[model samples]
Target: MARTGALLRQAPLTVALAVVALVVGVVTGSLWSPLAGRPLRADLAFGLPSLEQGRWWTPATGAVLALEPVQYLPILVGLLALGGFAEVRLGTGRYATALVASHLVGVLGTAGLLALARGHGYGYADGLARQTDAGMSAGFLGAAAAATATLRPPWRGRVRVLLAAYPLVSLAHVGALFDVEHTLAVLFGLALGPVLLGRRPHLAWRQLTRRDYRLLASGLFVLAAVEGLVTAVAPGGGPLFATLSVQQKHEELANADTLLGASIQAVLWLWLARSLYKGRRVAWRWAVALVGLAMLAQVAGLVYLAVRHLPGWPAGLYELLGNGIGLAALVVGRRAFRNPSRRRARRTAGSLLSPAHEDQRAAATELLQHEGTVNRLAWMTTWPENRWFTDQRSTGYVAYRVHAGVALGLCDPVAAREADREQLLGAFADTAHAAGLVPCLFTVTAETARHALAHGWHALQVAEEAVIDLPRLEFTGKAWQDVRTALNQAAKLGITFRVGPLSEQPRGLQLQVKAISSEWVEDKGLPEMGFTLGGVDEALDPQVRVGLAVDADSTVHGLTSWMPICAPGGGAPVGWTLDVMRRLPGGFRYSMEFLIASACMAFRGEGATTVSLSGAPLARAAPPGGAAETGGSDVAQEPGPDRNALDAFLDRLGQTLEPYYGFRSLQAFKTKFQPRFEPLYLVFPDEAALPRIGLVLSRAYLPDAGVRDLVTLARSGH
Candidate 1:
C-alpha cells in the first residue's frame, strides 16, 4: 500500500492518463465489450477516414479508448509503465505535452502516409487506410523512446534496441495500422529526444568492443530466425509483403518441405547465435558462409525473375538487401570472433610443447637470468607453460598465456635494456593483436602501468605486493610481537627451518612436501589455483629455493618456495619472492609466520637486500572508505576512482574465494613481516574488453575448472 502510494505520487501524469482511459472505457460501456463495430468507435476512432471527414478531435478522443475489451489491459499497463517512466524522466509538464503531441502526430502522420498510397494499388496500405484504431500505445511508446536519451550506456543501448526492434519486427511480421503509427511515433521521438535533451544524436561505432560485436551478430542471427519463421507462417502480409503471380500464389508453399526447411534454418541460426556470442571462430565462419550463400541465392533468384520477366522481382530485391546487410555485419565484425573450437584449441595447445616453443622458453629463462631481478615476478616469466613474445630486435620479451582469446601477460617484460621496456610492451600488443588476441598485462608495476596509460590504456589495481627491505627490517617492535612469538613457538616445538632447492632435499622430504600440498588442495572445494600462484612442480626448479618447517621426527609441518629476484645484469641475487606456501592440517599454527621471518633473515644474511611476500590475488589494503594507498616508490601511483565497479567486483570475488583460497588471510599473514604494500595492476587498452579480460583471468587461474565447479561456486554463496 505504501509502495503504491509512493508510485502514485511520483507519477501523477501517468496515473491521470490511466484514470482517464479506464473512465472512458467504463462510461462508453466498452470495458467488458468490443469498442469496435459500434457507433462509439465511429465517433472516437482516429484514422484516414476520420481525418478526411474533418473529425480533427477524434485523435484526442480515440487516444483514451481501446479498440477491444481485452486491449484495455495493455492500454492501462502501458500507460502505467512506459508513461510513468517518461513522466519521471521528463516531469509532468513536458511529459503531458509530449504525450499529446506524439499521439496527434502518430495518428495524423500514419493516416497521411496511408492516404498517399491508398489508391496506388498498395494492398496493405489501402486496407489499413479504411481501418479505425484507438489506443494510447503509440503515445506511451514515443514518450519511452524519447526518455531513452536520459539513460546511460549500456542501459541506453539496451532500451533503444528494444524500442527499435519491437516496432520494426512488428511492421515486418504483423503489419497493423497501430504498428505503422507506433513505428512513426518512436522514430519521431528518437529524433526529437536529442533536441529536447540538449544533445545531438551521433553514432560512435568505434567505441564498440568485441563483446558488442558478438551481441550484434547474435541479435542478427535471432532476427534471421524470426524472419524465416514469419515467412513460413504468413504470406502477402507485413510491410515487406511478398507479391506473387496468380499461379505462384495459388501453389501452396507451407507444406512439409517448407516447414521442415524453416525449422532447420531456425535451429541452425539459433545454434550459430549461441556460438557466435561466445566469439567462436568456427561459428563466425559458418555464419558468414550461410549469410553469403543466402545473398547469392537471392541474387540468383532476382536474375532468374528479371530474365524471365516475372512480376514479383521486388520481393527478391528486399530479401537480397537483408542478406547483404547481414553479410556486411559478419564481415565487418570478423576480428571479434577468434576463439577456436575445443578440438582446434587442443591442437593449438600442442604448439606450447613444440621445438620452436622450447627455444623461446629457453630464451625466456636466459632473459630472466640476466634481467629477472627487475621485478620479483620476473622469475614467473620463466615458467615452462608460458608463451614468449620477443621484440623484432630480440632486445626483450614478454611472457604470456592465451585464454579465451586474451594474451594475458604475467608481469612486466624482461628487458635486456631499461629503454626496451616500453618497446617490448608495444611489440607484445602488436603480436597479440596480429594473432587475433586481445593483449592484457597483469600484476605490473606502477611504471609499466604508467607507460601503458600514457599510450591510452586503462589500469585497475588487482593486488598489493608485500615488500620487506631486509636492510631496514627488524623483529623487535611491538608490531613484530607476532613474529617473535612464532619464532619462539617453533624453537620450543623443535621445528627447524631448512632452505634450498627442493630437488636437493631428500626423497622423503620431497614426498612430505607433496603430501602437504596435496592435502591442502584436497581440503578446498576449488582446484589448486595457478597463473601467478605456483605449485609443487614450479617449486622444484633447481634455481628456485624452498623453505621447509620440519619437526624432530622428520615430519614437515609447513613449507614455502622462493623465486630468485635477480638484478638487471646479474651478480648475486638481490631479493627473493615468496611463493607456494602450504602447511599440514592440524599442524603448527605459527608455521607460516616462522617460515616467512626465517626466509627474510636467511636472504638478508645471504646479502639479499629485499624479500617479497608476494601479492595475494584479489586482496589489497585500503583505509576505510578511502583510496587504496600505493606506497612511495620510484613512480607515484594512486588507486583509480573510489567505488569503482571493477574494484568492488574484485573485492566481492575475494570474499567469495576467501573460504576456498584464503587469499585475504594470506595477505593479513604477510603484515607480520612489516612489509610495505606496492599496488599491482592489470592494464589494458580498451574498457570494452574488461568483461572478456575477467573471464580470461579466471580461466588462466583455474584452467581445469569446469561448469560443475562454477555451479558449485555459485551455490557456495557468501
Candidate 2:
C-alpha cells in the first residue's frame, strides 16, 4: 500500500490525466446520448471542415474526451504506459510538447490534405472533411515513441521495431481514417525522439548510423516502388495509390511509368546503401543524385497537383521529409566510412600487436604485473593472436580480435584494480560501438560477467576453465593414483623431464617437435584452431617456456609449450598454461601424463601456484534446444529430431579425438590435483549480435573448416 502511494505520488501528472479522462467519459456517458452513434464528441473532435468553422482548438481538447466508458479503458491504459513513461524520462514540459506536437501533426496534416482533396473532385474527400474523431491515442503513440529514447540497449531496438510495425499493420487493415492518422502521429513522435533524448538542436535531423541510413533508403525506395506496383495490379487501389486519381480515373500508362521510374530508383537506392556501408566515393554521389531526384519529383508532383487543383502531391511527403534529414546527416557523416582494403575480410589482431607497436606489448606486460596470482591463460594476450585496447591512463588494457563487424574481446579487461578494469571495459564498449562493431567477450570470469551486466551486457555461461592451485594441491589420495603411476613409469623408462625456454632448446629437438606436431595434424585430418589453441609458431615467443619429456639419448618423446602468466609489468612468470601440447604418434603411451606431472612440480619449485588447461571450444554444450511439438492440449512428448544434432555431433567428435587430443580426458585427469573450477562466460552487448558473433568466432577458430571437413569429422569423429 505504501509503495502504491509512492508510485502515485511519482506519477501525479499521469494519474491526473487519467482521472480527467474518466470524469469526461462519465459526464458524456450519463448526461448525453449519441446523436448518430457517436456521443456528443463532434464538438471536441477534429475535422478539416469543423476546424475551418472556428473550432480550431479541437486538437488539444480532443484527447480528454471519449465516446463511452468502454472506449475510456484502453485510452486510460495507454496514458498510464505512454504518458507515464514520457513524464518520467522527458519531464513534464517535454512530454506535453511531444503529445501536443504529435496531436497537431495528425490533426492539421490530415486536415490540410482533406481540404486540398475537397477543393478537387475526389469522391473520398467529402466524407473525411466532416468525419470528426476524438481520442488520446495519437498523443499516446507519440509519447510512446519519445519514451524509447530513455530505454536501455536492445530494448530500444525492440521498441523501434514495434513502432515501425504499427504503421505496417494499420496500412494492411486500412478500414478507417484513425488507422492512417495514428501512423502519421507515431512518425511525428519518432521524429521528435532526438529532442526527448536531449539533442535540442535540429532534433528531426540528427546523425544516423550506417544501419539506420541504409534502412531509411531501403524504406523510401520500397514505398515509392510498391505503391506503383499496387496501383498497377489492383483495381480501386490503395489509399496512397487512389489519392493520385482526383477524378477517380485510372491510367495504365501512368502506372507503368511510375513503376519503371520507381524501379530504377529502388536499384539506385540499394546500390547507394551498399556503397555507403563500404565508404565509397561513388556512393556519396549516388546518394546526392537520388535524394535530389526525389526532392525534384515531389516538388514537380505537388505543383502539378495544385495546378489541377488536385489533392495528392506525394502520398508520403511527411516520411519523405524525415528521410531527407537522414540523407543530409549521411552526407555529414561521410568521414565514418573507410575504403575497403584489397585483402579478404577475416579476423585479424596483428594490427594492434605488430612489431611496430612493441611499446603496446610492454604496456601489457606492465599491467599483468598488477595481479600477483594471475591465471595461466593470462599471458595469451601478448601472443600475436590478440589485439589490445589500453586505457587512456595506461592503468589497464583489453585484448580482442575483429572478425566481420564483431569485436571479440579475449576476456574482461586486465587491470591492477577492479575499478580500473571497469573503466577500461566501458571505454572499450564505446570504441566498439563507435566503429559499428558488435562487442563480445569470450571466456570471461564470473566477476567480469557481473561488471558487464552492470553496463547492460548479457552473459551466457559457455564453459568451465580448469585451474590447479599448486600450493593446496596434493597427489596423495585415490584420485592421485594415475598421476603417481605416470611419474613412477617416467623413472623406469629413463624418460627424464626438462623445462626451459623453447628458443634456447637444441635445434634438432625443436625440428623433431615440429615434425610431431605436423604428424598429429595430418593424422587427425582437421585444421588446427587458432583463437584459443597455439602451435609451434606461438612457441617461439620470448616469454613462453617449453617442457619436454626425453630419454638419455636426447630423443624428444613429447613436448608442451607453457605460456607465462606473469605479473603485470614484464614481471617474473608467476603461472603457466599448456599452449602447445603434442607427442609423436605411437611414440610414447604415457608421454602426456609424464610431461604434465613434471611441469606441475617444476612450476611449484618456481613459486608459481597455478596451471591452466585451456577451454575446449564447442566441447561444452550438448545441443541447441528446439521448440517441442505439442500433443494437442497436452505437454510435448519430445523435442524435434534435429534439435539436438549439434550437441550430439560435438559429443561424437569428442569421442573420435579422445585417443589423440584427449581434451576432455585431460580435464578429467587434472581432477587428481582437485583444482578449483572457474566458470567462463560469453558476454555480448545484446542478443541481436549473437549470430554475427557466432559466425565470426567460427571463422576465427577454424579458418580452414569447410563442408568436406565437417563431413569427414562427422563421419569418423576425426
Candidate 3:
C-alpha cells in the first residue's frame, strides 16, 4: 500500500487521468452501452465521420471514456501501468506532452487516412471508416513506447517489443478502428522517446552473438505461431484476413478442418520454437523445410494467378513475406543452430566435435593424459563441450569450439611429441579454413605462441600465468607475512584445510561448497564465466583435486579446485593448476589465502614440483622491478611494432571487466605468493580478424550473458 501510494504520487498525471476516466464512465451511461449508439456516435466518438461533421470536441471528450464497461478494465489498467511508467521516466510535464501529442496525432491521422480511403472500395479502410473508438489506450501506449528509450536493456528491448507487437498483432487479429490508432500511437512514441531524453534519434545497435541469433529465430517462430492461432480462433476480417480475395476467404472459412489444421500448425511451430531457442540443428532444419515449402507454394500460387488473369495478387501475400523473412533468418543464422538432438548429440558429441567418434570428451581425456602438462590450461581442452581437430598423423590435436564463425582453440594443442606440437597448430588453422571458419588460439604458452608467430601469425599477450616452485615455497620472509597470518588465523578459528575430490566430500559439505560458489556467482552483475575458467561442475571431476577450508562445525568457509598437471608420456601428475576459487561472503575474512597456502603446502608434501595459480585474463603483473601498483598504468603498452588498436582495445577491455570479474585484482592477489609470471598470448593468422576475435572471446567467456549484460559492461566503461 505504501509503495502504491508512493508510485501514485510520482505519477500524478496517470492518477488524474484514471480519476477522470472513472468519473466519465459513471456520468455517461454509454460506458455500459455502445457510447450513444449509431446516430449520436458520429458526434460523441472520435472517427472520420465525427471530425467531418465538425465535432472537434469529440476527440478530447472520447479520450476519457471506454465504449463498454468491461473494456474499461483493460483501458484503466493500461493507463495506470503504462502512463505511470512514462511519467516516472519522462517526468509529469514531458509525459503529458508526449501523451497529448500522440493521442491527437493518432486520432487525427487515423481519421484522415480513413477519410481518404473511405470511397476507395478497400475492405479494411472502408470498414474502419464507419467505426468509432473511445479510450485512453492509444495515448498511454505511445507514452510507454517513448519511455522505452530511457530504459536499459534487456528491459528496453523487452518494452519496445511488447509495445510494437501488441498493436501489430491486435491489428492483424482484430482490425478494429482503434487498433490502427494504437499502431500509429506506438510508432510516434518510439520516435518521440529519444528526443524527449535528449538523445539522438539514431539507435546504437549492438552486434548480436550466436546465442542472440538463436533467440531471435526462436522468437520469429513463436510470433508466427501466435498469429496462426489467433487467425484460426477469431475468424475475423482483420487487416491480414482482409488482404485475401473473396474466393480465398471462402476457402479459409469454408470448413472446421481448416481451423483444426491451423491450430495443429501453430502447436507444431511452438514446439519447434523451443528447440530453436536451444540452438537445435534438427529444429532449424525442420523450420527451414516448412518455410521453404510455404515460399514455394506462394510462388506457385502467384504463377497460377498470373496465368488465370486474376484481378488481385495471390492470397496470403503477408504470409509469403513472413515466410521469406523466416527463411532468410534460418539460412543467415544457420551456424548458430549447431546443437543436434539429444540422441545425435550423444552419438556425435557436438555437431562438429568428432563426427566419427562416439565421445570426443573421452578422446580428449585420453590425449590429455599424454600431453595435458603442456600448459596450465591444457586440461581445460578435455572439458565436455570442446571439439577435437586432429593433426594429419592423428598424433596431436587441438580442442576448440565454433562460436561466431571462429574456431577458438583453447591453450596449446595436445601432442605426445614436441615436434608434433608446431605441426598441430598449422593443421588446426588449415582445417578451420577448409571449413570456412576463422581460426585463433587463446591463452597459449610462449612455446605455442613462438610456433604460431614463426608461421606468420600475430601474437598478443592476453594474460600472465603465475607459477610457484613448490620446493622453494616458504613463508619465512616479510612478503609471506600475509599468508602466514591467514594460516594462523584460520588455525586459531579451528578451520582446517582438506584436499581431495569434491565428490568424495560429505553430501552436506559438498552442498555447502556449491552454495558458496552460487553465492559468489549471484553477487556478480554478470553471469558466471566459462571457457578457460572452471566452475562447480568442472571441480566435481574425479581427476581434479579440490581444496576446502572448513571449521570444526563442519561448515565450509571456502574452496578451490586444482586441475592435474601431468608430465609428458602420460606420466604421474607433477603439479597442480589452481581453478574454481570461491568463499562464503562472511564466513572467514582470510579463507582464500588460507586455502591457497594450505594447498601449496599439501602439494609440496606430495612431492609436487610446482603449483600454477592459473592466469588472470586481460591482466598482467608489472614487469620485473617496474611498479608497486596492483595494475600498472604503463602495462597497457607493449614494446612492439604490432602494438596498435587491438592493444588499446585489450587494455580498455581489461579495465572494463575489472569490476565484474576482478581480473586485475586477482593478478594482484597472486603477486603475494611471489610466483613467476609467464606471458600467455592469443595467436591468430590475420589482424583483420581482431575485431571479430575480440567479440568471440567475450562471447566465449560469457556465453550466457545477454544483451543486458553487455550493455551493463559498456556502461561500466564510463
Cα lDDT of all candidates, in order?
0.80, 0.66, 0.81
Clashing pairs in model 3? none
**Candidate 1 C-alpha lDDT tens digits along 1-718:** 9868887898998998888988988998888889767888888989999888888899989998888899999889988999998887777877776777777778889998998888988777888989999998989888888888876555577788889888887786678889899998888777767766778977667666666687788888888787777766765467565356656545536442266788898999999997887678889899988888878877887889889988677667777877787777778888888877655654663332122367778877877787653567788888887888776664778888877767889888887566688888877776565344678899998878888877767778788898889898778867779889999999999999999999999999999999999989888967888889999999999989999999999899999999988777766678999999998899999999999999988989988998888899989864222222237645433342221556666777778788899898888777667677888888887555677788888778788888988887777753
- Candidate 2: residue 124 Cα off by (Å): 6.6
Model 2 earns a TM-score of 0.63
TM-score winner among the candidates? 1
Q: Where is model 2 more than 4 Å wrong at Cα? A: 1-236, 246-261, 274-289, 314-375, 568-570, 621-666, 706-718
Please give the range of 10 consecutive residues that has the lowest summed lDDT in model 1.
621-630
Which candidate model has the greater TM-score, 1 or 2?
1
TM-score comparison, 1 vs 3, better candidate: 1
Count clashes in each candidate, considering only residues at least 3 apart in sequence or on different chains: 1, 13, 0
* Among all candidates shown, the one with the greatest lDDT: 3
Q: lDDT of candidate 3?
A: 0.81
